[model samples]
Target: MGKKETIRKKSPPPTNQPVKDVYPTPPPLPVKAPNNGRKNGSTTTGNNCASTTTKDLWDDLFDGGYRADVTIKTDNGDIIYAHANVLGMASPVLRGMLKRAKGCGEKKPISIHGVHQDAVRVFIRFLYSSCYENEEMKEFVVPLLVLSHAYNVPRLKRVVEVELEHGLLNTENVVDIFQLSLLCNAPRLTLISHRMILKNFKAVVATKGWSSMRNSHPGLEKELLESVIEEENNQKEKIRKSKEQKIYLELFEAMEALVHICRDGCRTIGPHDKDFTQNQAPCKYRACKGLELLVRHFAGCKLRVPGGCIHCKRMWRLLELHSRLCADSKVCRVPLCRNFKEKIRKQSKKDEIKWKLLVKKILRTKRIRGSVSFLVSSNSISS
Candidate 1:
């Protein structure tokens, strides 16, 4: 009944007072269930955070296994990377060339060490993609040739040669393709291209000249000459059978007459005369006189005069006199002699009228005889 007994009684009465069971109040009826019916922090449900952690670990392991150093620098200033084995097989120079050739920017560089940039790029694309079916390739053939030679890629070189051959076959590109083929030392390409070039032999040979061709491609010069001869023969055959046979025949006769006058004028003038020889500068008095004599002879043919007629003979003699007199006089040399020039001019005018009449007669004759059997025969021989 002292202080201890009072304290004990107070504590005991506190425990027995209603004895309310203190069970957890059912977790406050969960404000909202976790999404997808997953219980928070419950092992029965899948552990998304743990799964994410496991994935991260696997990723680290996979990354570690696959990592490699594959970067390389190229001679032309290109930086690239490949697998170790690929690098081993590739030549150091080639690797550099490829990188520089491909370049490393959004805008590609123009040319590599003197080669056109687009050409090198095309080559790189072929190396990597194994295809070169672009139109740009046509203009970039020389650069491709350079690349092939440098890389020692025989297959690629062969492909370029094929493309060059095809290009040469196109009449429009024949000259340029032929030139490139010769420069690149492409024998087969040159041979194939030569055939196409022969089609325009007269125009090409005349403009480019045999001397220039000989100097540039001495090896092919003889061959080209032969081809030109063949083409000329074929052209002659065609002319023989053409509807314009009369026109062609007259032209040939005119040319022959012109040649005879030139030769006769030169012989009459004498080689010692500055105007008459190769020693004289071109376009001089002798040259003009020679050309004038040829023109006069051609005109005389249209006038229906015999080759040895007095008028033709007189015209030839006058042309020779004109050359001898006009050798040093610039004015008369350019315009020819005033009196002789007037006579030749009048004759030329009359000859032109006669030629026109003859052309009309030929056309009239062709219309009346509608059979083109001659043309067929000519075409067969020419073709």
Candidate 2:
């Protein structure tokens, strides 16, 4: 009876579990870089891929000939196909026009005023390529510059500005460009134009553009005149500084020459022709303001004295020069020992450092002293 009852009582059914995935989708096979191997995995593809995808969806649409629901027409009746998204991304002005205009679609030609077909062509190309330049591209610059400003394409405007800087600005076109720059609110272009005009003011002023500007825009002409005057003032100041620097260098050379001359007694630089041949007396020439005084002082002065001789330096330098020229250093018999090899070496080494330091000293001296004299003593020649 118990075994029959066990058979009658049924066991509870087993719970079922869903199957787990054998392998997570093998993480997208690691991307392969180019054969160059220099590029890492992170290096993005080409500009085409970027322009066609994230940064330039319009580029992809334009290339694929899709979603291009509008037509842009130039003044020459030349037609250009474009996507609204692209034009909108490039220019707020275009975006605003598209938003405001009615029935402006593929059927209706959106006339872009005052732009030539060639310029419109380049402008469209730029929106897709993000760049433009070359010899051929230069001709289109003015038109493109105008179009970029009108359309509010700042990036295109910036590129054009940099190109103008590299361009060969000349008298024929600089005035036109300057006026255009003012009209377009391009400060960099304006600045460059001003520089070109100032550099070649005579040539630039002679041009038709300058005359046109002068007659039509006198305010700008006045500004140009003011700039020219300002430039002349700047140039004059530069010349003055240059002259001052030259004088300073000459003064330094004179000082060096003077010290050398006094260090070595000059034979001709004395009042002692016979050294008082009859009486060994101080010569009367020592009391005069002439070559005699210069000669006597230079022939007898002690150069190694701690306190230096400043007043007689120039005269001494002149005498030393005469001595050097007269003495053939190879057989120099002068008491100055002009031929002494060690003396030459010592002078060279000593003067080398002094020469370099002179420039700095000159600058300091110029700053402190109001001005240095270029005038020399009338008796310098006699001395």
Residues 1-383, model 1: lDDT tens digits: 56664344333445555645444445556343223321121223453454434434433432342332343334566533333333223335455544554434432222236565456555554443234544656677667777776666655677777666655246555565576667667778877878766766656655544456678778777777787888889989887667565654433333333333433344344222335555643432333454555555546465534355656654555443333223232333322345543453456667646544543444344445553212112221110
lDDT of model 1, residue 137: 62
The per-model lDDT (C-alpha) reads 0.49, 0.61
Model 1: C-alpha RMSD to truth? 29.1
Model 2: CA > 4 A from native? 1-67, 104-109, 133-136, 264-383
Q: How far is each candidate from the true structure, as Cα RMSD in Å?
A: 29.1, 17.4
**lDDT (Cα, tens digit) per residue for candidate 2, span 123-164:** 876776464446435787788789888888887787778777
| Clashes within 3 Å, all models in order | 3, 1
Badly placed stretches (over 4 Å) of model 1 are: 1-112, 165-173, 179-185, 203-223, 230-383
Give the per-residue Cα lDDT of candidate 2 at 224: 87
